[model samples]
Target: MPSEQDLRTKIESGLPDLHNLIVTDISNGCGQSFDVVVISNTFEGKNKLQRSRQINNLLKQEIAQIHAFSCKCYTEAEWSKVVV
Candidate 1:
């Protein structure tokens, strides 16, 4: 039953070096689904699937609270391209 603020706070605290983190609740007020986009240097050398696995592992507990998750994980270089 955590609020979006609580979720964001937890993610931020857990990922200190993450550059961009976005979490959206998509469960029609049920808090059971979320869409997340995270950009981090930690993902620099990883493939897409590996990056996703890393995020899944970090948010294992939170993931249990969500029934569905749409995630986009990106490295710093990829993020820079999008920002430009």
Candidate 2:
């Protein structure tokens, strides 16, 4: 089981040029599941599957110890559009 902060830090380090990251524990504080949002320039040229694979590889270890995991990745430009 990995805490939100732990996963956040791991992702932050693994993904360079990170614009934003949000890690939520969806397992009711049990740390068994997580939902993550990642925004970074590193993902600028990638498609959805490519972005997800990057995250999945980065969190492979932590993910193995958890039950459920979901991630959404976007470039800073893409995120701004979504938020606006």
Q: Residue-wise lDDT of candidate 2 within 1-84, one digit each (tens)?
A: 789999998998888999999899988999998999999999988999999999999888999999999999999999999999
Give residue 53's error in model 1 in angstroms: 1.1
RMSD of each: 1.8, 0.7
Clashing pairs in 1: none
For each candidate, give its TM-score against the true structure.
0.81, 0.96
Best by TM-score: 2
Q: The CA-based lDDT of model 2 is what? A: 0.93
lDDT for 1 (candidate 2): 73
Per-residue lDDT of candidate 1, residues 11-75 (tens digit):
78876578888888888778888888898888877899998887787778878877787789888
